[model samples]
Target chain A: MAIIEIEGLAKSYRVYQKKEGLRASIRGLFRRQYRTVEAVRGIDLTVEQGEFVAFLGPNGAGKTTTLKLLSGVITPTAGEARVLGHLPWKRENAYRRRFALVMGQKNQLWWDLPAAESFRLHQQIYRIEPSRFERSRDELTSLLGVRHLLSQPVRELSLGERMKMELIAALLHSPDVLFLDEPTIGLDVIAQYNIQSFLRHYQELRKITILLTSHYMKDVAALCRRVVIIAAGRIIYNGSLSGIINRYGGQKVVSLQFIDGRIPADLARFGEVILEEPPRAKIRVDRRVVPEVLSGILAGYSVEDVSVEDPPLEAVIAEIFSRNGEPPEHQVGQIPELLKEE
Target chain B: MSEHPSYLRVLLTFARNSLVRDMTFRGNFLIDAFSSMSWVFMNLGFYVLIFEYTPMLGAGTGWGKYEFFVFLATTLIINSLVQTFFMTNADEFGELIRTGSLDFALLKPIDTQFLVSLNRIEWSSLGNFAVGLLLLAYALGKIDYSPGPAQLVLYPVYVLCGVAILYSLMIALAATSVWLGRNQTLYDFWFYITNFSRYPMEIYRGPFGTPLRRVFTFLIPVLIVVNVPARMLVRPLDPRAPEDFLLPIFAILATIGSLAASRWVFGRALLSYRSASS
Candidate 1:
C-alpha cells in the first residue's frame, strides 16, 4: 500500500560563486568558480496509499527539492525514488498521468484565459475521457466553490480564487498521487481555511495519496496526521504530529495562579520564566521534570491553580528545525533560549 | 475510460488554448499583428529601392527583380512559420525555467519538446506569411514562368525543409536557457543568422562575401533554404548547371541533419536541467 518509496535520495546543485564588486564580475566573466550545494542529502521515506503526509522544513531545507524529485520535475543526484511503483525521474507518460504537482509560487494555468479553458487543456494532456473529465471537472469546481469564477481570466482572480482555480485545474484528471507545495502561501485566513477544508474533503472522497510541503503550521496541523521534518537537507524527525511534541518537544508550559501576592524570586531554579505577572506566572519546564517542578512550586508557595500543557505545535516544530545539526546535550537548553530570542 | 486521445489532439488543444489566450487581449493582438505587418512591408520597400538602382542582385548572377522577389518571399514564408509556431514559445522558455513552470510541463504526459515548442502560437505572425504568399504569386506572374507539376510539388517541400531548419535552430538556442539561466538575446542571434537567408545567395560572392556564402550554403544550409525552393520554381535545372540539380538532394540532407542535431541538443539540455530548484 506504500504508493511512494524513496530510499537514499539526494540532490545537489552547482552554484556559481560571484564576488560583490564589479571587478569580480569582470573576472568571473573570464574564469568562473562554482560550489556544489547539497540540497537534499539522502532522505529516506515512504507513504502509504491514501495517506496525507506533511513534509515540514524551514526555508532552504530541501522540502521542495524532495517534492520536485518525487514529482519527476527534476532528477536526483543519487539514489532512487519510486512513486506508485514507477521510477519518478524516468518520467514515463503512464507515471505522469497518475500524479500531479502543484507549486504555490508558480502557476500552471494560462494567465490570459479562463480556468475552464485550462481545465480542458488538462483533459487533453491527461487524455481523460469526456464523461470522466466532465464529472471530475464539475466536482472539483463545485468543491472549491469557484464555479462562477471559472469563466473569468485567471489574471483577474484574487490570490485565493486563483489558488483555488489552480487546485481545480490540477485535480481535473483525478490524479492518484498529489504533491502540494505551500498550496495556501499567500491567502487570507478565510481563504486558507476554505482550501484546507476542501483538500481534506477531496482526499476523503478520492482516497488519493498526498505529500504536502508547507511553511504554514496551520496547514500541516489541519490536513496531515503524519509529519516528516527536514532540516539542513536531511530528515531530522518523522512521526505523527503530536509525536513531535513528545520527542523534540522536551518542554511543557506550566502556568500557575498564586493565591497570595507573594511570588518566589527563585522561580528560575524550577524552570525558565516565560511570563511574570503579580498573581499568575508562566514557566517552561522540562517534560521529564514537570512533576518535580510542580511539586516544588506548590511546596514553596500558595498556588491557587496550575495548568500544565505542551508548548504550541509551531514552537515544538521550530525547536525540531532549530536543533538540526547540534549534539543532543546541546539541545537540552536550546529551545527555550531560542524561543526567548524570538 | 473510453479511449486515449492522440498526440495531435493534444497539440490542437494547446493551439486552441493559446488562441483563446491571445484573443483575450483584443487590442494588443491587433496592434501586434499590425506592427508585424508594417515591418514586413518596410523590408519589401527597402528591397524595391535596392533593385531600382541595380538591374540584377549581383553582376553575373541571374537574380533579377522577379527572382529576388521570390527569394524574399521564400524568406518571409520560412521565417513566418518559425515565428508563428516556435518563436514566442522559445522566448518564453527562459521565463519557464526561471519561474519553475517547466516543472508542470515536465509533469504532463507528453513529449517535452513537442509541448515546449508549440505551447504558444503568435497568430499575428501569420500576417507576414499571408504577404509572403501574395508576393510569391505576384513574382511568379511577373517572371512569366509557368511551373510544371514537378516544380510546383518541390516548391512547398523545400519551404517545409526551410521551416524545419529554422525550428531546429530556435529550439537549440532556447534549450541553452536551461544552462545560461537567461537567454533573452536568442532573438538577436536568430535575426543575425536568418538575415543572410533573405537575399539571393549570389549577393555574397565578393572576396569577403564568398567565404560567408559558402559557410551559409554548405555549412549552415540556410542559403539553400530559400535559393533552392525559389530556383526550382523560377528556373528549371539546365543539365549544364549541376548546382541546380544538387539543390534538392542537399535540402533532404540538411533537413535530416538539423532535426537530428537539434534533437540531440535538446535531450542533452533536458538531462542537465535543474528546474530552478535552488
Candidate 2:
C-alpha cells in the first residue's frame, strides 16, 4: 500500500524583490517589486508502506518545501497530496497524531528544560497512555544511547546529543510516517554515522514509512535504498540508488597496479587518465568499452591487479544537479535523457 | 487508540515547563518580579497623590477616591492576568515567526492558539495580581457602600471577560507578524490601546471626551473591559439610565465578538505563514 500519494503538487511564493542602494530602498517604500517563485512545480510521487525514501535536491530545489507541504506546515498553490490517507494541508488532528516531522536546523525541545520535560509535554499533547509512553520513551532513549543525558538541560547537551533527544521526542508517539529534512546536516562524521545507524535500525524494527531529505550523500547511501532527485522544482529522477548510478553514470573507472612499479608514459592513449602514480593508475572509460580498454592496458603493461567500478554516487549526483537546468520531468518507470552535455 | 488529552492537562504541563524555565534564570526572574511590583506601587502612589486635591476623579463622574481605587484595582487585576498568561507569548509570536519555530507549535495535535497563548506563564507578573487583590480589599473597606452577593459574583466573571477582550486584541495584532515578518511595535500598540481602559468611562464625556468615549466603547470596546466590571462592583447601575443597563450586555457581546474575530485572524494568518526556510 502506498502511504503517500502526491499528484501535481506545487507551491509558489510571492517575494518582494528589494533593489540595492538608497534610492531603490526609498522607492521600495512606495512601489515595491515582487516576483513569484515557483518553489515546487507540479510533480507527482508515491511511497509504499515501510519504505525508506530519500528526497534528494540541491539548494532551493523544493525538497524542504515539499516536506513542508506534506507535513501541513505550508499549503501548496496547486494540486493534491495525501499522507497516511489524510490530506496533509487540512492539518487534521488525527493526521497530525499519526506522523511526525523533524527539521535538523530547528529545535523542538525546550531550551532551558531537560529533554525529559519536553517528552512528558509531548505525551500530554499527543495524549499517549502513560504506560505506553513510558515504554516508548525508555526504549527510544536506550536505543539512542542518551538515557544518561535525559536529566540534563537541553541547552547543555552537545549538538549530536540534542539531535538524538529530538529524535526520541519525535518517535515517542510511535508515529507511522516520519518526515526528516536535513537530519544529518552539520554533524560530525561520527555523529552522522551514529544517527544513520540508529535510523536504519529503528526503521527495520518498526517498518514505518520515512521520507528523508539530506544533503549528506553518506546518509542517503547508508539508509535509503530508493532515491528521488528534484531540481528546478521538478523531479528528474526517482528509482533505486544503484539505478541512478547505472542510468546517469555511463562511465566506469578502472584502477590498475603495475607489478613492475613503473609508469607507462603512453597510458593516456587507452582513456582519460584520472590518476597516475608509479605503482598504481586509474583511467575513466566508457562503460560499453571498459573490457576493451582493460584488455588493451593489460596487453601492454605488467599489471598485477585490475578493477572496474562505477563512478562514485556523489560525483554522478553532482553531475545531474549541475545539468538540472529546466529539467524534463521524469515519470516513474520511464527513463529520460538526463545529464547529457548541452 | 490514544485519547485526546484534556486541554487543562496540556495547560498545566505548559505552566510547569515555564516555571522550570524561569527557575533556571533565577536572577532575571527576581529582577523582573521586583520591577513589576515597583511599577505597580509607583502608579498607586501617583493616583493617591492626585486624589488628595480632588474628591472625585472627574466632575459629576460619581467616581470618588475609594471608587476610583476600586477601578484602579480592577485594571491591575485584569492587566496582570493578561501579562502573566499572554503578554510574553504574544510578544514572542513575532520572534517565532521570524525564526520558524512556530512550525513546531503548528505540528502538535492541539489547538495552535491554545499552545501559542498559554505556553509560557510569567510568574513575575503575578506580583501585580497579588497587589491588586490587596488593594481591592482595602478600597472596598474604605468605601461606605457595600456590594451585594450578585455584584460580588459578577465581578470576577467580568474580570475574566476583560482579560479575554485584551487577549483577543493582542493575539490578533501578533498574528499580523505572519505578513509583516516582524511586528516589533506590537507592545507599543497594545500599551496605547489599553491605556484608555485604565481610566473610568465616566471621564470620557462632554465635547471632546464624548466622541472618544463612543469610539472606545462601541468600536474597540476596550472601555467596557474595566469600566463595566468596576462599576458593577463599586458603583451600582442607575435605574433611570438605559446605557448603564446596556453596558453589561455589550460587554458579553464584545468578548464573544473579539474572540471570534481574533480566531479568524489567526487562522487566516496561519494560511499565509511562509514557514521560514530551514
Candidate 3:
C-alpha cells in the first residue's frame, strides 16, 4: 500500500529583500520590499509502505521544504498531500502519532535534562502503553548502543551521542513512517557509519516507510534502494539508485593495461583520456560506443587487460545537482561535455 | 493503536521535566528565586511607604490602606501564577520560532497551545506566590471586615480568571513572534499593559483617568483582572449602582472572550509560521 501520496504540492515564502546600508534600512521602516520564493513548486511523488527512498538535492533545492510539508510542520501554498491516509497539514493527532521527523541540525530533546527524561516525556505525549514504551525504548537504546548515555545530560554528550539520543526520542513511539532531513549531517565518518547501520537494520526489522533527505552520497548509497532527486523545487528524477546511473551516467570509464609496458599515443581518439600511465591507461567513453571504442583500442594496441565501469555515483549526483538551475532537457545533452571537462 | 495522552498527565510530565532541568543548575535556580522574591519585597516596601501617608487611595473610593494592600496581594497572586506557569513559555515561544525548535513542538500529538504554554514551569516565581499568600492573610487580618461564604468562594475563582486574562494577553503577544520573526518586545508590551491592572480601577476617575480606565477595562479588559477579585474580598459592591453589580459578570465574559481571541490569534499565527530553514 502507498503510505504517502503527494500531488502538485507547492510551498512559497515571502522573503523580505533588505538592501545594504543605513539609508535603505531607514526606508525599509516605511516600506519594506518582499519577493515570493517558490520553495516547492508543484511536484508529485508517492512512496509505498516499507520503502526506504532517498530524497536528494542541493542546498535550498526544496528537499527540506518538501519534508516539512509532508511532516505537517509547515503548510503548502498549493496542492495536497496525505501521509498514512491523513492530510498532514491538518495535523491530526492520529497522523502525528504514526509518523516522526528528525532533523540533524535541530534538536527535540531538553538541552539541560538527561535523554531519559525526554524519552519519558515522549512516552507521555504519545500515550504509549507502559510495556510497549519500555520495550521500544529499551530496544532502540540497545540497537543504537547508547543505553549507557541515557542518564547523562544531553548537552554533556558528544554530538554523535546526542544525535543517537535524538533518534531514540523520535522512535520511542514506534512510528510507521519516518522523515529524516540530513540526519547524519556534521557527524564524523564513524558516527555517520554507525547511524547508517542502525537505520538500515531498524528499517529492515520494522518494514517502515522512510523518506530521507541528505547531502551525503554515502548515506544515499548505503541505505536507500530507490532515489528521488529534487532540484530547484521540482522532482528532477525519481527511480531506483541504479536507474540514476543508467539515465544520467551516460559514460563509462575504460581502464586498459598494455602488455608491452609502453605508452599509447593515439588512445585519445577513442575517448577522453582520464589517466595516461606507461603500462596502463584509462579513458571515459559514451556507453553506446563502448564496444567500438574497446575494439579499436584492442585492435590498435597490444592490450593485455581492459575494464569498463560506470562513473562514480558521487560524481553523477554532483553533475545532476550542478545543473539544478537548467531545464531537464538541457541536462542530459550537456552531461557529456560537463563530464569531459571534469 | 493510537492513544492520546491525558492532558493533565502530560502537563505533570512537563512540570516534572522542567523541575529536573531547573535542579540541574541549582545555582541559577537559587539566584532566580532570590531575585524574584527580592523584587516582590521591594514592591511591597514601596506600597507600604505610600500607605503611611494616605488614609485611602482616593476620596470616597472605599480603598483604604488595608483594602489597597488586599488589592496588591491579589495582583501579586495572579501575576505570580501567570509568571510561574505561562510567562517563560510564552517568552520562549519566540525563541523557539527563531531557532526552529517549534517544528518539534508542532510535530507532537498534543494541543500546541497547551504544550507550548505549560512546557516549562518557572518554579522560582512560586516564591513570590508564597509571599503573596502571606500578604493576603496579613492584609485580611488588618481589615475590620470578615468575608462572607460567597466572597470567600468567589475570591479564588476570580483570581484564576485574572490569571487567565493575563495569560491570554501574553500568549497572543507571543504568537505574533511567528510573523515578526523575533518578538523581543513581548515582555515590554506585557509590562506596560499589566501595569494598569496592578492598580485598583477606582484610581482611574475624572477626565484624564476616566478615559484611560474605560479603555483598559472594556477594550483590553486588564483592569478587571485584579480589581474584581480584590473588591469581592475587601470592598463591598455598591448595591445602588447597577454597574457595580454587573462588573463581576463582565469579568467572566471578558475572561472567556480573551481566551477565545487569543486562541484564534495563535491559530492564525501558526498558519503564517515559516519554519526556519534547516
Candidate 4:
C-alpha cells in the first residue's frame, strides 16, 4: 500500500478582502466580505512507500498549501488524504509521530536554547527511547556537520548552521515520511549541496518517503525522478522529470560570444541574434539545424567563447503556464523568435 | 508508560527551565523580583487606609484590616502561581497561526495546548508567591486564630483548584484568536475576571448578587480559589460545610469544560489559520 494516498484532495480558505479606510474598518466589523481562495483544487496522487517526489510550482501555486493539507497543519475543504493509513487532518499523536514537516522560513528550534535542549524536548514529546534518541541525534548532528554547534543557542548560529540544526531536530524521531517546503532555500551552494547529499544518502539507507518543494531546480533534478507540478490551485503536470523537459523544453540554446565580430551586423543570415557587442551573440537554430547554425556562426565571426545548453527551466514553465490544452512543443528557438516579435 | 508526565516531574522541569531562562537576563530578573515584592506592601496600603475610616468589614463581618490584607495577599498568591506557569506563549497564537509557526508546533508529536502554553517560562511570578506567603504568615500572627494541619492541607488543594480555574479562563480567552483574528485581547478578559475574583465574595452576598456571585461561584471561579483560602486563615472550621470549598471545587470542574471548549475552538481556528506572513 502507498505510504501516502491523496484522492481528489481539495482545500479552500475563506479569505477576507479587506476594504481600507476608518469607516470601512468599523463597517467591516458588522458586515465582513470574504472570498474563497481555492488554494488546492482537487488533486489526486499516490506515493508508494519510500518514493522520493518533487512538488514544483510558482508562488501561490498551492505547493505549500498542499503540503500543509497532507501534514495536517490545516484542514482540507474537500476530498480525502491518507498517510500511513491515517487521515492527516485527524492529527492524532500517533499519525504525527510517523511524519515530519520542515519549512525553511519557519523554525522549530527554540531560539534561546542550545540545539541539544530542543532535541531533548522533542524526544520527550515523541516519547523516543533515551538510547534511540541519542543515537539518532548523534548521527544527524554528525551528518549535517553541526555536531560542534550543539551547545550554542540557535539564535547565535548562522542561517546555514541553524538550518542544519533544525534538520537534526526534525529528524530525531525517525519519521516514516519527510515533508520539506523549500528546505534548501537561501543556503549557499556548498550548504545546499551538503543538505541534498545528506537527504539522498539517508533516503537510500532508510528508504523513507520524501516529498520536497523547492525553487532550486537542482534539488528536484538531483533528488527526485518524479515531479508533480501544481498551478492555480490544480495539478497541471504530474510525470517524470524527462517528461517535463521533453514536453516544455525544446530548441537547445547555442550562445557564442565572438571575440572580434558584431553578430547582428555580421551574422544576421546565420540565425537570430540574441546579444551582440565586442563579440557576436546568437540563439542557435533548432537541433535539426544545429550543424548549419554552428558552422554559419563560426564562418560569420571570430568566436572566442561558446556554450550550448538546454533552455532555462523558468521559460519552459512560463510556456506551460500560458499554454492550454496540448502541451507546448520543443520549439526552443521559438522563444528568441517570440522575443524578437515582441 | 504514564499517559501524561508525573506532576513532580512536570513541576521540576518547568521550574528549572523558568529559572535558567530568567537567569540569563540577570538585570531584568532583579528588577522584576523587586517590583513583585513591593506589590505585596502596596496591597497592604489599601487595607490600612480603608480601616482607618472603619473598624471592620461592614457591620457583622468582624474581619480586621490586617485580615483584609491577608485576603488580598492570598488572592495575589493564587493569581501569580497560575500566571507563573499557565500564562502561555500561546497567547501569541493568533500571530503564530498567521505566520505558519503553529504548523511547526502542530507537526510535533505533542498536545498543542500543553506545548504552546508551557513553551516559555516566566519567573517573576515566583516572587509574588513568596511575598504573598510572607504576608499571610504575618497576618495570621496578628489575628487571634491559627490554621491547623487540615487548613494547611486545604491550602494547596484550594490553590490547585484556583490555578485550574484561572487556566481555564485564560484558555477560553486565548482561544478567541481563531475568530477574532490577530489582536485577540486575552489580557482584557483576564482583567475582567480578576476584578470580581480579587475582591472578597461576602461583599456581594445576597439575592440580588446571584448572577454577580455566580461570576466567581461558577462563571470563572476566581472567588472560590482566593476567598476560600483566605477564609481558612480566619475563624474555626465549620462542621457542616467549611470555608466554602464547594465553589472552588465547582470552579475546577468548570475549568475542565473550559479547556475542552478551548481545544475545540482551536481546532476550528486551525482550519482557517492562514499562517500569517509578510
Residue-wise C-alpha lDDT for candidate 4, range B22-129, written one tens digit per residue: 777788889987887787667677678888999778665555677777787778788887777777565765567656688887786667777677766678778888
Badly placed stretches (over 4 Å) of model 4 are A255-271, A277-280, A284-308, A321-342, B1-14, B205-210, B236-252, B263-274
DockQ for all candidate structures vs. native: 0.62, 0.76, 0.77, 0.41
Model 1: CAPRI class = medium
Q: Model 2: per-residue lDDT, tens digit, A297-326?
A: 888878999999888777788877877745
- Which portions of model 3 show Cα errors greater than 4 Å? A259-261, A325-335, A338-342, B1-3, B236-241
Q: For model 1, report DockQ.
A: 0.62
Per-prediction TM-score: 0.95, 0.97, 0.97, 0.88
The local distance difference test score of model 2 is 0.90
Residue B276 CA displacement from its true place in model 4, Å: 3.2
Q: How many backbone clashes are present in model 2? A: 0
The 10 consecutive residues of candidate 2 chain B with the worst lDDT sum are: B236-245
Q: Candidate 1, which segments miss by more than 4 Å at Cα?
A: A261-269, A299-301, A326-338, B1-5, B236-240
lDDT tens per residue, model 1, A1-342: 889999999999999998999999999998999999999989899899999999998899999999989988889999888999999988888888889988888888988888898888888878888899899888888888898888999999999999999898788888899999999998899999999999999999999999999989999899999999888888877789997777667788898888986568889999888888878888988788998998898888999999998888887677677767443345544445326521
B179-244 in candidate 1: lDDT tens per residue?
Answer: 888888888988888888877766787799999998998788778878888888877233428877
Give the chain B TM-score achieved by candidate 3. Answer: 0.97
Per-residue lDDT tens digits for candidate 3, residues A1-342, read 999999999999999999999999999999999999999999999899999999998899999999999988899999999899999989889899999999999999999889999999899999988899999999999988999988999999999999999999999988999999999999999999999999999999999999999989899999999999898999999899998888888899998999999868877888889887879888988899999998888788888898999898888888888878466777665544435424
lDDT of 4 by residue, A112-153 (tens): 777887787777777778899999999998888989999888
Write down the TM-score of model 2's second chain. 0.97
Q: RMSD of candidate 4 to the true fold? A: 3.8
- What docking class should model 4 receive? acceptable
